[model samples]
Target chain A: MNETADTMNVPRSRAWTLFGVFAFVALIAAQVHAVLTSPADRDMGHLQKILYVHVPAAWIMSLAFLVVFVFSIRYMWRGQEKDDLLAAAAAEVGATFNGLTLVLGMIWGKPAWGAWWVWDPRVTTTLVLFMIFVGYLALRSFVDDPERRAQWSAAVGAFGAINVPIVYMSVRWWRTLHQIQSSPSTMDSAYVLGLRTNAIAFMLIMIYFIRRRYELARLRRATELIADAAALGGT
Target chain B: MNAESSLAVDAQRIARRFGARWCLRGVSLQVRPGEVVGLAGANGSGKTTFLRVLSTLLKPNAGAARVYGHDVTRAADDVRRHVGFLAHTAGLYDDLTALENLRFAAEMLGRSPEGLEASLDRVGLARVANDRVRGFSAGMQRRLALARLMLMHPRLLLLDEPYANLDAAGIDIMNAVITEVRNAGGAALLVLHELAPAAGMLDRVLTLVDGRIAAEGDGPAANAPTASAPTLASAAGAR
Candidate 1:
């Protein structure tokens, strides 16, 4: 058991380091490729460059939330502390990306729709998803017991996940300022390549962020256990 | 296996560290079936940490603990099944009545609520079983917690400061509950600050100082005054 745990730790740290370097290179490459290869849109010109950032951020935000949902369920089902930590890590990363998506969307909207903010279904539901997880993080902070916190947060994480699909479908379900979902097949090949490359870069960065966050969470739990032991003393 | 063949609590070279300090440094002890052992320790001496570790709530930083030969870390589910832990707090929901609290515990443990009323009566809380715990005195809440323990009938009892906040009657009830558990061939590790109150009920007493066992003796030996040792109550208060 000790050997397995030790071996796993080495690989995980190395993997995170590799992901960090790769993500940085991929992000720069994607940006350069999009600028040089993709033609300016006739309608919006260079403003369309924002899609490379906006769409990928939105995709990764949804992906991160999906991770939270899965890990939260696993925590509840298996009652493992690692699962709870992973869920928390995913939620934190997801919240950051969700915020980025909103900001980027707003920036894009300012030029495309002549408004910085709107009550569009896609925008409103994504905002709600972000707020729900923010509330979930706040709830975790308020609970003192580790077990109780895991149980409550798992419930909140699961409930918050229901909003992900709603946010994804919102643009299609309603006539909104937000455009319908786009796919690689639906867009010009160059635009598709740029978007895909940026998405991969963002995904790698998100994984690295969540992994590091999980490490911090584990360290915090260890410190808490030690402190608890110190406070209580030996019987 | 017979009760005598199985160890109720067996902890060996246990160590739990916090930052640079060790709260439980190579502490080890054992309790057999039908034995009631009292643990007297100064504040922050790691009494509660030991109990929490044995109860499968906290993992020891080193060494191993077993209840009936089931390792705490490897078989926590089995350890949990055989152990009942009552901390200084009642661990009860204030909104629930005494009866409701027991019912909730019973449900969580997957045990029927058939004997909850009897258990409440045993703890002298039957008269106020329907009263909300929010309105109960500290002693009453403690009794309700004891009632919950009685219903569970765990094979090993880990009581941290069981005498805390209890009146004379409550103390007697707590003693009776411990005696009953021993009489049924279960074992108990009772963590206390004062030896005088539980001395008569203890088969043996272990004194902890600086996170290690300083001494071990029977009831009479515990009552013998030691100039350097401070009672748990005094040490706890100083902290």
Candidate 2:
């Protein structure tokens, strides 16, 4: 009993800590190169620079939600606490990127559309997606029981996952002011490298965030179990 | 048959800790079929922790345990099939009527809803069958929980503080349930804060001190628990 029972409670390895260092460095290098090298857009000029941050943030936001979806299903199917913790970590990361995507979209929208905000279908659905996950995070806070919290989070993840594809296709499905997704084939070649570079950078940063959050969630679960063990006068 | 298969519980050197405090320090016990064992310990003595481990609600920090023939950690779903766990709380839905609660439990346990009225009657809740649990008193709620146990017919009962919040009649009802388990050739382990109320019925009593099984006692006479038996003496030495 004196022994530390779980490997999960161990501190994050030095390798991962070093990876965090590398990820931030990569993000800085990627951003600096993209902003300096890309030619100004014919119409939008320097405003095109925001795409380096905006587009990748949107991509990572969706990717994070997809992680939540996969892990949520895994939690439901397997009832493993690790799957639930991982899904929760992805949701927190997804919400952060979701907010970033929306904020950047607004920054671009103000000049591009002559308004800071719009009710465009893509914008509306993305905002809904953000709220849905923020609500998921909020729902987790209100539950005290770990098992109940996991089940509830999985339910909310199901709703949030369904909205991801809709947010992706809002431009095509509803034909709103939001532009269709950009790609290497559609964009000028000079911008593609910057976009792809930033995408990888954002991905590394997202992984770092999710892993850190997951480790904390596991630590918290350990305490919760200890507390439950100590309940009813545990010695 | 193997010792594990013949015994209702076979816990081997079980241990658990909270931070630096060792709550269950290499404790071990074995109870045979049709026995009603009492686990008597003071506050903070790990009695409930041991019960939780056996019930598959909590895992041991060290060692292994089996409920009947199933390994509690690996074959938990199978162990759960034969165990009825009654925690300190009633684990009831306050909004559901007495009858509705039994029906829901029966459904979850894959038991038929038939004879639910009879089940409620056995626990003296049939008269209040249609009333919501929120309106019931603590004793009544415990009765309702006992009613649920009858529905499951689990082979082993891990009851935590079963005598708490019960009146004299309620205690009698509980004792009858324990006897019922024995009569059905099932076994039960009861966690007790005090031993007298349930003394005569217990086939064995194990006293826990600082997370170790420091002592044991025999049937009925178990109210005066003695030092550890040979099996746990070796485990205590291992610690």
Candidate 3:
């Protein structure tokens, strides 16, 4: 019962330090292994190397959104402030990765598709998903009431998550310019190992970023509670 | 503990801090069923903060507070179920009509809106029951909030400056409702700047200075024009 107050009081700086070292080492190693071992495609050549960053970024973005959706549902159902904190943290990180994915895709497209932008279904839907969560973050900033903010943002977060699946399946559903989903079974073995290693690296960094963001949010909430207490003059 | 002995509010050695300064320090009080306690304090003195902590809107940094035996920190939902909080804001939707606001409160509390009209009439806002709150005057909006509180029938009422923006008739209505709640065996902790008008309604009055209780006495002494009284300062100093 007494544990609720400090439930989010994890050793934040130490964990972040460990994650920073591990992520940097793992990412450098994975990128090196991926570039050196995977042979360039016959048609796309070096342009295919962009897949290691772009595809893994998209995966991490989707994973972050998934965390937002689950945490948002938990927040609404249980009305725990910590759950809302996690949801907000995940949304911010997810939006960053979502933007990164879009930019990387655009960069990859300039070389492979001969253009910087396209109105492909996958690309368009991912843009829309990004906007929804961005709007969620905006709403949190505008609302003053903690409970109201949590309720409204959780609803938006959950709705934004619905678009994630649509974005993932857009290529298959509408026959857009974007290619269909890839899997290790269908890909060349050389590319598969590198892609898998990079995916792990990206996942580690995403988790680290979300945890650090969550810690920052917890500190902010604590400060706000203190200010409220001070203003009211209650013990 | 037996059901009858359960205090409506029980706070012990509660302390709250904002950065380096403390808002409430070692402040403690309790209210039994049928008790109406009026808390008097100057601006920025922490009356509202204390009510907020009791209502479970803010958690204390140290010590504990319970509403009807439910811990404010651990069982906030349980505490909220039995508590009605009238904050500095009316907490009403501007777009919703007075009746709609009461209905929304009822829906949120999972209670039936059986006496919605009666509640409105009690607060003297029945004529404007269907009018949007955005269009209502501050006193009328406060009346609408009071109606919502009456409809909710909470066991513990935490009212922060309930008389703000109220006219004479509105104040009368507010006083009548507070009296009615006490007569029905519920408890209320009212935080107010002026105690003269509410003196008759309160069973006890506590004067807060710099976050701690400076003076405490029965109703009449609280109503005595002590705005600049040396006794209060001396009491605060003696502490």
Candidate 4:
């Protein structure tokens, strides 16, 4: 309720730059750690290294989607436009990472599993999550008015958010043929440390993305309102 | 004999600005219980802005408005509970049936399921209860919105162009409903272009020109022959 215009201008560039440096360092460290600490699995060979990128990216994607759901609900309840803008920004960033996660997962899956794609529980659910976000973005684009857009998008965000838990649960409840939760609990301490660092770095990257996108949204809202005011009456 | 003596709502020097432009400036008025007040204005004359502020949809930049002792800003939820606002959009779900739309509104307002059926019939939409609003004509949708209005039975009704684009039958039904509300001791602020059309239903008439009240109070302009060109100072000085 006490928000001001200055709140929208958080230092996005500083955040982005810091996250970029962290991600780059984490990338190099992950590769080095993989080379020094562990031998390639005899079955999957060198392809397993992709886990360093694929797994953390997947975690970050899910986290971003979670942010989208939280902010969307907050927006609807409070009617605060900032929450709506943040939700949209997070959904966009999440979709980008989710798309990347899916592509990289497929890349890792092909040789190890002897197929380019499989109807595995985790993969299928992630794909569905991607489609839901795609629908969210499409819905946002279709609406024109800011308040109406926010209201409708919040509803869509809420409905689509219900799918997230379902996606997570499907792998556990029925197990339609995805790898059981092996990666999170089974990794060695050093490997876990690398993955966690990468995940934190990715989170920082997403924070930066959402902040920048929010700035753009603020600018768009200002421009549209200006045009409306001008059209109404401008001497 | 006189339920109209008490003021149902009051606005004290209410002012709202969008950026540099003031939509309402130094606007003050009183709405008596059982009285229908008509807010007449030209396009962009700030009627909608004023109503939005009063309804707690948009916060005012200055001054205060109270609905039945509830402060609009500090106690917005309380204000919302007592105020029923129907903006130009009708605020209805186009995908749901007339009954379904009213039922959802009823649920939102925390009305019992039993009341939903009665409210639908009250608004004359019981015959079209099964039909989806997507297939509803403008009149049908307007009736559906009226059904939503019945669910709340609000103390202060804020309607923005409720009769606009409505057919003759729609207007008649709306007039009847509004008249019934005023008779039941509810204060209403109706924004309309043609005051003469609704003048018979209104207890008082107020004109807004350039974000300030041009002239207002007690019945239509009876004595003033050329009330249209009232000076801004005279308008602002209205009690």
Q: Which candidate number would show the highest lDDT if scored against the true structure?
A: 2
- Per residue, candidate 2 scores C-alpha lDDT tens digits across A1-235 of 2223264474759999999999999999999999999987787778878889999999998899999999998888988878888999999899999999999999988877677787666677788889999899999999865667889999789877887666768644655445543321246788889999999999999999999999998887677555544542332
Q: How high is the CA lDDT of each candidate model?
A: 0.81, 0.83, 0.80, 0.74
Per-chain TM-score of candidate 3, chain B? 0.90
Q: How much is the lDDT of residue B176 in candidate 3? A: 87
lDDT of 2 at B103: 95
In model 3, residue pairs whose N, Cα or C atoms come closer than 3 Å (at least 3 residues apart or on different chains), thus clashing, are: A232-B46, A232-B49, A233-B46, A235-B15, A235-B16
- TM-scores of the candidates are 0.73, 0.73, 0.71, 0.63
Positional deviation of A91 in candidate 1, in angstroms? 4.7
True contacts kept of each: 0.00, 0.15, 0.23, 0.00
lDDT per residue as tens, model 4, B176-227: 8888788888888888765544647777878888777876755555223355
- Scored on chain A only, each candidate's TM-score is 0.84, 0.87, 0.85, 0.81
Tell me candidate 1's fraction of native contacts, as a decimal between 0 and 1.
0.00
DockQ each candidate and list the results. Answer: 0.10, 0.15, 0.16, 0.04
CA RMSD (A), model 3: 6.0
After superposition, the stretches of candidate 1 with alpha carbons farther than 4 Å from their true spots are A1-26, A66-94, A132-159, A170-190, A197-235, B1-5, B13-26, B56-63, B71-86, B91-137, B140-148, B165-170, B226-239
Q: What tens-digit string does per-residue lDDT give for candidate 3 at A33-58? A: 98887787777777678889998998
Chain B TM-score in each of the candidates: 0.90, 0.90, 0.90, 0.85
Tens-place lDDT digits, model 1, residues B21-139 = 67787688989998999887778888888898999888776778889989999999988888989988888999989999999988998898787888888888899989999999988
All candidates in order of TM-score, best leading: 1, 2, 3, 4
Ordering by DockQ:
3, 2, 1, 4
